[model samples]
Target: MSAPCDNQTGGPERPSFVTDDELERALRDAFARRVATPRPLAADPAGLAVRRARRVGRRRTLTGLALAGVATALVTTGVAQLGAPAGRDGTPIVVLGDPRGSSPSPLPAESTAAAPAAGPVRPELDLIVGSWLYTNGGERWELTGVSTVERAQRVPDRGGWLLTSAVTAAGRTLWWVPPNGRPPQVLLAGADAIAVAADGRRVAWRDGGEVFAAGAVAGQLLATTRAAAPAGAVPVGFAGDTVLIRQPGRGGFRVWHSPTEDRLGTVNRDVLNVYGVRPDGLVVGQVSAGTPRRPCLALLDPARELAPVRTGCDPELATDGRGDVSADGRWLLVNGARNAALLVDLDALGSGGSGQSAGPALTGVVTWTRAGAALHVDAAGALVRVRPEEVTAGEQPFSSPVDGVAPGDRPVVVADSRP
Candidate 1:
């Protein structure tokens, strides 16, 4: 009736339907008896071993592929970081330090406006006015504990940048200006002369014919070598791992490689004053040429074997060892005549003619502030920026403690920015 309720009724007591093929399979499986067959105990052992080995090889291959994929991902991540902005390049902004107990002043606040899309912000010039160190912004930082600063140099060491100063007090001392603005650390208490690596990672100082080497950070001494420096010898600079030293009036400078303290070489046998050392391992100095009163600037290789490259004889273009070579080693500025300053590209210093015009004659000492410019300190303690294009000098709102400077204010030393 009604086609047997369509085998599976839509009513409550519905019957389950089974196909003939399924019923047959189920019946066969329930009634069929399996035949007993002997399985080979250990078929060809070598064949089995080969099959097992193949499986292991496949597993190893898959694992290696996975590892390779991970490695590729890691390398890709590193490459991406490499392309990130210079802010990730480990470069640091310039900062100021004080010798007195005062901490390092905080860096200027980052501008809220969009930053310029450019490479690193070039460091500006730093000034050492009397016992005070002034930032480019005219902030007067006290050089608290130290007395008189003979020479000041901003150093970029491995640990961090430091403001390295050679101080003259009871005796010569080497003071370290921490980038964090911590109180100045005494690198060497009793030191006659000091030389810092342009990178600011290493320092070498001489005290009574003995030389000591240390890391830029405050800590124990790195090494000591007896008779490393001669009497009255000052650490002029560092050329790579070698330390260059010379007396005030010595005809030349000698080089001593650190750790081993081996004599590397001597340069400028007849040159009088070794002025500045470039980061590229070149040295600048003055030598007697033409006449005793007439001196010429010389570009010399720190290696003794190289001959001195002298500027064409210029009597007025004399240097008082009061100048600096640009961190890039492309520019050099030295004090010329009393009212004039000397400017020369290091690349062309060897070929320039005598008495080449280097801009207006500036009074007082001309100390390099940046690359192609020099900070001319007038007799009245006023600082004027002299460049290849123009001069920026005048009375402005310089931070206090400077007090617009007093009559006694003088530029005892200069601590300028470096690459």
Candidate 2:
């Protein structure tokens, strides 16, 4: 009778991480006579096939994910680019092989006081502190200007949200490295809510109950807070620095949150994958708490305001891209079943060709990022790394790894900054 979880860090949104055969079998029986598999993407080709069910599959069996990927290959959105590989939907996929991602901290969250008005806590901004990519050989990015609040109102300094700060920055640094704290007894630092930062000066992590930020010391705890959630909150997923969770207030609802447990947006609708959350704040979920039928994918917003995204891409590909985007919020590098892939910018207008041209070929699911928006194509000895800010519009923007090597083949994150 409680709300379902939508945490991106593979929370309830993904069912139970105990992806063992037992859990799978239990989940299977729960919906044995009620669930129905949807058609494959190959059938509609351009259109993505939407399946309906209360839960995709037990974490033990990502039957939905496997089948979904299988459908992607069979159906390509035959839609060409405006200028070939320039900005084929600028997206940033989840960076696999994240060094610090090695050890998951705990889950962070706040209790919903006694009453709803007992002062519901709000969310704040989460910053990247340390990681293998940054410490090894990359640029460090900081997350600042975040605070907590109630509802969708901005408080900026409610003091309930968590925050992290650094004293300096390094030119070649990739992430921050701390000194202590790593266990699963409480919450597993699984998935990602993990990163050290490119400057190698900060520490950020999710400690299950709530998010925490620190400077040079791991146990030094910078700040911590809970999500703008009700008493019965369900975690769906975690994206970039955000967490997707569901709770029961007036009724069942969904929303995006920060590591410190702050609400960024909300989805007041019903969906099937209520258990799914993408990276870019886009939710691939559903809620039938008060409804009478099975579940389906529903795009949710943090504030339950307007439609989530309407750009050239949106609700688009959260999982790095689609089922993908619900977590990272980009599509530059997406994760696939076999290999990681890239979303190449197709310029049908300029390249003067109708077919795919010579540029970059992502080896994984296409992912993207907004700040350092660069097209990284790792394929066929052609490393296309183009910073969108540096090029002119329609320049067939592309980027390949140093040697056109598929980074997907080997999760690379600028590691080497060790003792």
Q: Which stretches in model 1 have alpha-carbon errors above 4 Å?
A: 1-123, 128-132, 137-142, 157-169, 218-226, 248-251, 264-268, 289-294, 309-311, 337-339, 350-352, 355-371, 391-403, 411-419
Per-residue alpha-carbon lDDT of candidate 1 for residues 1-419, written as tens digits (9 for 90 to 100): 54443446655353468775665565545433332344643454444555676677787787679758856864775421211113223211111122233312344332233322321111256656544555555444555475555556666432322334445454466666554434455655545666766556677766654555555533223333334455566776776766766755645656666656454355545666665677666677676666564667777666663257555454355545656666566655565765555565656664644333454454433456545555555545555555554422222212112233446755533544345
Per-residue lDDT of candidate 2, residues 1-419 (tens digit): 85665544434544345655565465556654443665433343111211222233343256557647645643464321111122223211111122234322232232122321211011011211221111111222221221111001001222111122221221011122221212111111221233232222233343233332333222222223333334445443333344444443424444444444454355554433332334334544433332343332234554343233321221122222222231133222232223433232222212222221223434422222223343332544233444443333444555432321233332222211111
**Residue pairs of candidate 1 with colliding backbone atoms:** 100-144, 100-145, 104-181, 156-199, 157-200, 339-361, 339-362, 340-361
Each prediction's TM-score versus the true structure? 0.57, 0.29
lDDT of 2: 0.30
lDDT of 1: 0.52
**Positional deviation of 112 in candidate 1, in angstroms?**
26
What's the TM for model 2?
0.29
- RMSD to native for every prediction? 21.1, 29.8
- What local lDDT does model 2 show for residue 51? 27
Cα miss at 239, model 2 (Å)? 9.2
